[model samples]
Target: MMDMLLRPRIILDAAEAEDAEALAEIHATGFRRGWSADEIDALIADKTVSSHVLRRESLFGVRRPQGFILIRTVADQAEVLTIVVAPAARGRGYGRRLMEAALRALYRDLVPEIFLEVDEKNASAVSLYRSLGFVEVGRRKGYYAEDHGPGGTALVLRLKLR
Candidate 1:
């Protein structure tokens, strides 16, 4: 848990071209199959994709990115491609804030519904999504492979924005 007094000021902003490397680095901390900077750059260049980066600014004015959320929209629906927060920054409400900001942006853009897939075993993530009004619509059997054991299922969740 992060100490309240020690937590830095946080800012959430639309991701830009320069954020590709930072986004990739933060993503690598959370997932086994992380995206490369080049791949992130390509995705961000797409018109249908929108991304947000969360940054923390210290009292000394040093700023560093802590997390990011990437979304892709087609027609009236949007999908959360990824959401990652640095391990040290977890449990400090950054993930919830990032998701809130991303959802607001998608709603403003007229997206009627949003969807995402999460590993069924990730209790914290599942609880977070449920708190944000995402309900499970389906599940994929063995959608996520593990190194030491059998694969895990992926729960497909959807949130109605309109």
Candidate 2:
């Protein structure tokens, strides 16, 4: 079926330095302001950051990146820096999968809690985080820049990993 073919086999792997450009491209599609390839590369190279990429391997052995998630761990806690899925690949559960991968890795590492900030206007993203058991613990006023006027508030969400 078309659905089966499109699904393929997903392989989640630790993101490498070479993936910066691809990840940046995906990030650009998902955000108002995107991180540069250099920035993503630097994050991947940092000792405290954990980055994961999801690749879709087709029936004919074609492998391409669908999404990526970046998490920074400090001591007993971790924070989701960013997550983005390719524009064409959106709404196919890739975001959830990427978040799940990050959660599993953090849990395995014995991280007690994880936190992330999301624009309050991003309904889908907020919904996804809530579904994954994240609850809003705080808010930052006008934390996100807007094109025309005042920026939106950022909702700080947290999840207990332990």
Candidate 3:
């Protein structure tokens, strides 16, 4: 049984190449088609990409990642490549915290606008984006493959940071 009284301390930090495996593991917990560690490592190695990880520290001082977010920037614009929180860590405000941190970082770097694509059928994610002030600017048909059916549409959202 899980101990409800001993909550782990959540911490956010910049992601490094060595965190690729942990990021992949968290991604796999949330998505059916998760990116591999090699893919995450290659993306993190890119000069234009910035990533962050959310970690949890247990009472014994053992730390492990619980979520991650990846962003790519070009000139004054930035795009969220991906963000995922482990299944067990969902509903704990980790996603919102990650987005807040990423947006602040982008804003500090002089990025005036940011964008992201989310599956249209993902209500929770869509709601979260809306709460974060992102508006749906476009949609891509059949952009994401569904787990049990045909492909799904992807909603492209944009947020003005400036």
Candidate 4:
């Protein structure tokens, strides 16, 4: 589905190192700790791995990349490496749109399911996944370390893409 605002113009750019600097800022802003430019470059530059940024109309400041999702296809499945949205864009439904686009882009044919891990304490994010029919499949102990009291666990969730 196309973005309403962009209206037949949503541009999905394969993020490069040059875009990493800006992506790092957004990632750091969304998560407490963001990756460095080199880190983003490493993850995105791998030809086998797919990294993308969703721009409203174009890559320019049309709507400065409100969200991002990274995926790596493994066999008949695709694992979501990371997904984030700018703090200011959190409640605007960008997260949902990003997930939808990511799933369609990466696993439209071979993969029938997609999986990801999410911090258990992130209620909003959990809710969003559940709303998209993601069911809890497992859990990882102490996966997220934060500045808060103690780092929380991560819940593994999966959704059938059929």
Query: Model 4 reaches what TM-score against the true structure?
Result: 0.82
Task: After superposing candidate 1 on the true structure, give the runs of residues whose Cα lies further than 4 Å from its correct spot.
Answer: 1-7, 148-150
Alpha-carbon deviation at 160 in model 1, angstroms: 0.6
Best by TM-score: 2
Q: Which 10 successive residues of model 4 have the least lDDT summed?
A: 1-10
lDDT for model 3 comes to 0.91
Instruction: Output the lDDT of residue 154, model 4.
Output: 93
Worst 10 residues of 2 by lDDT: 142-151
* lDDT (Cα, 0-100) at 5 in candidate 4: 52
State the C-alpha lDDT per candidate. 0.91, 0.93, 0.91, 0.77
Question: Could you give candidate 1's per-residue lDDT for residues 92-143 as a string of tens digits?
Answer: 9899999999999988988899999999989999999999999999999878
Span of ten consecutive residues with least summed lDDT in model 3: 1-10
Candidate 3: which stretches are off by over 4 Å? 1-6, 147-150
As for lDDT, the candidate ahead, 2 or 3, is 2
- What is candidate 3's lDDT per residue for 115-157, written digit by digit as tens? 9999998999999999999999999997998667668999999
Query: Taking the tens digit of each residue's C-alpha lDDT, what string does model 2 give over 63-130?
Result: 68899999999999899999989989889999999999899999999999999999998999999999
Each prediction's TM-score versus the true structure:
0.92, 0.93, 0.92, 0.82
* Candidate 4 local lDDT, residue 4: 62
Model 4 / residue 66 / CA error / Å? 1.8
